[model samples]
Target: MSCEECCQRRGLGGRMIPVPGEVAAGCGLAWKTAPEAREELVAALEADGVPVEAMTVIELLEFR
Candidate 1:
């Protein structure tokens, strides 16, 4: 299953947070849910040569 689907199964609100760079695609997870795996995601992007300046959680009222 896709990451989005997997996250959804875990009851994570769906929202996409920007990755470090355009080199890698972004994700589909709400900031709240995304924050849970923020460290791992940032690490992966950084390791892929993407610029990881910051990794933070933003509370979004809407999914779009």
Candidate 2:
């Protein structure tokens, strides 16, 4: 997927994972990335012609 490819190309920290339960509804998946990467990521996604619905930043107790 584009998310995975974007991270790999830029060496960003993230992965494709199941969307958190609290979110209303979605494709049941999301690309988890560092909050700091949002801006660059948005640009990359736009360049890649990916339509982004929403992006949220939250603290996770652990991510690996």
Candidate 3:
């Protein structure tokens, strides 16, 4: 899936959520190349037996 796709899957977009840094690994990332690397990370984690799930995205545009 694309980076944006993955982010969307995790409920993140132009939104924010209150969570710890440990969950940062699943934030989909803020890199321009995230789409390229994300799938790999997911695959690697899955191969390593790591559980990954999507997170909730909270709209925070108003807070800005």
On lDDT, who's better, 2 or 3?
2
In candidate 3, position 35 carries an lDDT of 39
Please write out the lDDT profile of model 1 over residues 1-64, one tens digit for every residue.
Answer: 2444444545545455544233234753222344577656544444555454444555545555
Per-residue alpha-carbon lDDT of model 3 for 3-46, expressed as tens digits? Answer: 34554555443322344345455344432223345566566545
RMSD of 2: 2.2
Q: What is the lDDT, from 0 to 100, of the residue 45 in candidate 2?
A: 84
Q: What's the TM-score of each model vs. the native? A: 0.40, 0.75, 0.32
What are the lDDT figures for the candidates, one per model? 0.47, 0.77, 0.43
lDDT of 3: 0.43
List the candidate 3 regions with Cα displacement exceeding 4 Å.
Answer: 1-33, 55-64
Looking at model 3, the pairs that clash are: none
After superposition, which runs of candidate 1 have C-alpha atoms over 4 Å from their true positions? 1-33
Ranking of all predicted structures according to TM-score, beginning with the best and ending with the worst: 2, 1, 3
Residue 26's lDDT within candidate 3 is 38
